[model samples]
Target: MSDRVALVWDDAFEAYDFGPQHPLKPIRVVLTVALVRACGLDALPNVSAVIPRSATRAELETIHDPAYIDAVERISREVADPYGNYGWGIGTGDDPAFAGMHDASARVAGASITAADAVWSNTVEHAFNPAGGLHHAMADHASGFCIYNDPAIAIRWLLDHGAARVAYIDVDVHHGDGVQAAFYVDPRVLTVSLHESGHFLFPGTGFPDEVGRGGAEGTKVNVSLPPYTYDDAYRAAFERVVPPLVEAFKPDVLVTQLGCDTHATDPLAHFALTTKTYRYLARALHDLAHSTAGGKWVATGGGGYQIYAVVPRAWTIYFAELAGGSTPTELPAEWVERARAEGARELPDSFDDHGVILPRGRREEVDERAAAAAQETVARVFPYFGLR
Candidate 1:
């Protein structure tokens, strides 16, 4: 197998637009890829750009209901859903009906699935799909600006192909409720998420008690952090949950939802992480993939609304690390100028926003709260894996 990583990209992925005003903008992915090129990630010897094929109906049916799939297609074709009562979570405010919604969403899912295929087939040790990672779409409904649950479908693909232990780590601000629900009772898939507390976040439901059911206990781990948690606390919380669980599970393949909305500048949620924090997390996950899963890692992009300021910068560095390259202290000047010429807001001069997070105090309190959440998760979950 090659040490190269697959880079899944396509221009059509921009069609996943909810609208001009929706927080989940596709331009973020575009800017990310641009920065990847600007920083010479695309020219790396170990990185391969791949144009993915859209997933088929049968492929999607593995996780989505056929009727719901049909509803997505219908809404994509018609201006309005012919069956308004379908209740498939389409045509709503968050996920409104749009042209080519199903095709675009399935394409994103396919890009992710293709990355998974490469890693599983040993064609590549690692892969990335910056347009994928719609973690909030449920079995029969779309939520949180997501259409099809691509990461869940890819994990299902892995399970069907004889991988006994598949581990998923979601670092998005919102709970990865859709992916968790998909494999909550399946012992073969371990889904771990670190997010803002459900009490304070949207689509909120990733608590310590959701540690899978029956045979799958300990397979679902959640570290719900406080709203204002900064880089050190966030990293500490992530380490407290993810490393131990993944080491214990010893998965066949590790899939991650790399959502960058945890930054303090992000509009949707309240996390004080900077670009430096994103780099640390990505490098840690890369090391864990090699240490735990023999380097079989498939990562995808998720929720990041700070398109100009946060998403592009964070993900560009992340892609560089995943491609086995080093990130620069300062962003390429050409990309910053391009962003400015395009009228981007808060065009960062360097990868680090250099923002201070803890001037308001309460670091100890936040750390204690996060530590308690991790302990509760271990108390409820670790015994299933014969730990603690």
Candidate 2:
């Protein structure tokens, strides 16, 4: 197996902009790549960035309707509002079509599909597309600032390329509802999502009881966390649920959605995760990939709006760890200045701002809730996986 990890990226990915006022700004991605360079992670031997092209229409049809694709393209070219028909959720406040909407969205999807292909083909043991993970887009509509469901497209690509039993785990603050819906009745793909409970979040779904449909019953897993869930609670829930299920599923490939919106510093969500905790989760998932899926892991970026304070630092450490490089204790001074110039006022001076080590002991109350919920989930689905 190759020790390298492919980092799928390109400057064109910045074209995926909703607008200047939208919270899901493309600057987060730009800053993330800059931070990776500032931390000297770009120089790591095992890491290299790959440019991606827009995905072909056929590849997009795997997860989206052909008519919707055509609508997006038409709106992109005409620069007119098709809000009545084509805008199931498009041209709305969350997903406004820009000049190159179709191409930009397809490029993000292509990056994810490229990463999936690299990992599945063993050209790289692990791959990451921090530009991807637009998981909120459904088969027919866009929602929650997501224009394309890249995770679903990548999983479909994996299945087409001779893989069976693919497992997808989503850690975005919002539920992976679109991806779940795409595979809800397919036993071949197991979708597990750990997110702030849909009761309090957008696209409100992903209830624990809503595990898969028909013959694919129990193939879907969800841990609907309570609001204000901090690092201890988050990690406790993950430790209690994720690993065991992946082991039971025993998938041939592991695809994960690593959204940083759960951070306490993020403006959009209520979860209170720290950067240290996020890094820990990334490292844990990387380890899980090696153990359960022969190191075939495709990681994607999801929702995160705290552009400077959280997203860049968190993702920098994540890519560093994935590249087998040591996390830097301090931020590069030049990067901090550039961020301030770019309108980030609260950027941290160092990557160690969190000042806490990972795998922090689980809190008693959080542990109890997580344990109880996990136990219930296992009981509900363990029989299906024949793990009882």
Candidate 3:
């Protein structure tokens, strides 16, 4: 297997924009790439960028409904309200239709598939499609600003290409309900998500009891955390659940969705994760990819709203780590200026804006709450994996 890693990217991915007001701005991806390049990560020998084509209907239909695909295409062409039987999650508040919605969403999906294909085919040891990870889209409908379930499509691609076991780990603040639902009954795909509890999140689903169904029982793992979870709490929750389960699954490929929206500065989420903690999580996941998946890993971007301050820095560090480069503590002034020119407010000078390090010092009550919650998750599901 090749030791190089491919970073799937193209400027055309910015066309995935919903609108100016939408929180899921495509500029975050742009800024992330820029930040990585500014930090000299693009020069790394292991990290090569690949442009992706739009996913064909056949490729998309592997995980999405054909009618839904048609609806997205038809709605993308219409100038007026084309709200017929089109399951166009279009015309809705979260997923407003754009002219090139199909092209953009399909390109993102294709990017994810290309990453997975690269890793699985031994073209690269690891791959990242930071523009992908629209994990909220279901087979039939779009939800939570996601139009195509890129991770699910990529997983399906892996399965079709002879992958025996693929483990999907989602660290987005919201549950990865779409990906889980897509493979709920398939034992070959193990979906593990650690997110804010469903009670306070959108597309509210990933409960402890919502483990995989039928033959896939015990394959679905979720650690639903309380609202005020900070760095240490987030790390503790992940440590308590993810490592043991992934070790047990012994996947042939590891797919991960790293959404920076869990940061406290994000406009949409309640989690308090700092960039330091996110870097630690990325490193941990990367190590796990080597340990459990033959170093075959595919990473993708998910929901992150703090475009200026959080998203760029968080994902830059992630890509750096993936490329085996050091995470720079300081942001390039030129990159910050470019981001401002692109309508983003100036970001902080350093990646560590919060001052608190990994295993943050939280209030005792919050720490206790997070610890108790982690214990509850392990108590509920660890035995299913025989991790006792």
Candidate 4:
């Protein structure tokens, strides 16, 4: 078996920009690559950078409607509004229709697909697409800054290629609604998401009760953590849920959306997690990929708005773990200089966040809410997996 790892990337991925004010900045991915290179992880003998081809219309149709694809294409040529008049979530505040929107979005989707293909074909045992993980996207519309649901499209590709089963685990702060919706009724695919409760988050839909509808009933699992969920609480909930279900599912390949927006400093989400949780998650997911999915893992970057201090470091930690290597203890001097050159501030000196200390009055409330959410979620979905 090929043990090499593929880093699916292309410079054109930076084209998926939504203007100067959008939180989902393309600089996050660019900084991630630069950090990885600076840390010399890119030079590892087992790691290889692979340029991706833009996903063709037919391939995108695997998860998006043809009409929606046409709309995106039509809107890409127009410059009247950053947000397109075209429906299907196009031209909205969250997902503005930018020039080359179709090509750029398709390329992001293609990176994930390329990662999936590399792992499935044994050209590589693992792959990471820092530009992919547009999970909030639905079949027909853009949502949550995602134009196409690359993770779902990639999972579908795995299914179409004769894989008996596939498991998707999304760790973004927001519910991975698009992916869950995509395979909600397909018995062959299992999607598990752990995120900030939909009650207080955008797209508000990832409750425990939203399990699959028919034969796929038990396959969809969600852990709706409360806001202010700290590193320990978040990891506790993850431990209680993800591993057992993924192991039980015994999927041929493992796919994950590693969005670091769960960081306490992220402007968009309320989760209080730190890079410690991110590192823990990376190690845990790495173990699961090896133990449950034969090391066939495809990982993608999702949401992380703290472009300088959080996103780049968190993803570099993730990539280091994905490659079975040690993470750098200190941020490289060259990377810090480059980040400053780009107008970044409060750049971290280390990979791990010091910690998140909640106010005295808020600690109890946060822990209580977190514990209740985790317990309720386990109670709601364990029976389906035959787990106590």
Q: Rank the candidates by lDDT, best first.
A: 4, 1, 3, 2
Candidate 4, 1-388: lDDT as tens digits: 2258898889888899999988888988999999999988888889999999888888999999998888888888875788547788887889988889998999999999999999999999999999988998988889999999999999998999988999999999999999999999998888888998889998799998988988998888888988898887888888888888888889999999999999999999898989889889988998999999999999999999999999999999999887766667889999999999887978877878788898867877877777788788778878887897
In lDDT terms, how accurate is model 1? 0.86
lDDT tens per residue, model 2, 151-238: 9999999999999889999999999999999999999999988888778888788778878989899899988887767777778778
**lDDT scores of the candidates, listed in order:** 0.86, 0.83, 0.85, 0.89
TM-score of 4: 0.97
Q: Which lDDT tens digits does candidate 1 get at residues 199-290?
A: 99988699999988988877998888888888888888778778888999999999999998988888889888887688888889998899
Candidate closer to the true structure by TM-score (higher is better), 1 or 2: 1
Clashing pairs in 1: none
- lDDT for 117 (candidate 4): 96
In TM-score terms, which candidate is top?
4
Cα lDDT of model 3 by residue, 1-388, tens digit: 2258888999999899888888888888998999888998888877787877778889999988899988888788873642333455666778877788889899999999999988998988889999988999989988888888999999999999999999999999999999999999999998988888889888788877878889998888878887878887778878888888899999999999999888987888788778768878978999999999989999999989998888988888888778888766677878978998999755787866654433444546567877777777677767877876
Query: On a 0 to 1 TM-score scale, where does candidate 3 land against the true structure?
Result: 0.95
Count of residue pairs whose backbone atoms collide, per candidate: 0, 0, 0, 2
Cα RMSD for predicted model 3: 2.3
After superposition, candidate 4 runs with Cα above 4 Å error: 1-3
* Residue 157 miss distance in model 2 (angstroms): 0.3
Write out the backbone clash pairs for model 4.
83-91, 84-91
Q: Name the lDDT value of residue 143 in candidate 1.
A: 86
C-alpha TM-score for every candidate: 0.96, 0.94, 0.95, 0.97
Q: Which residue runs does candidate 1 get wrong by more than 4 Å?
A: 80-86
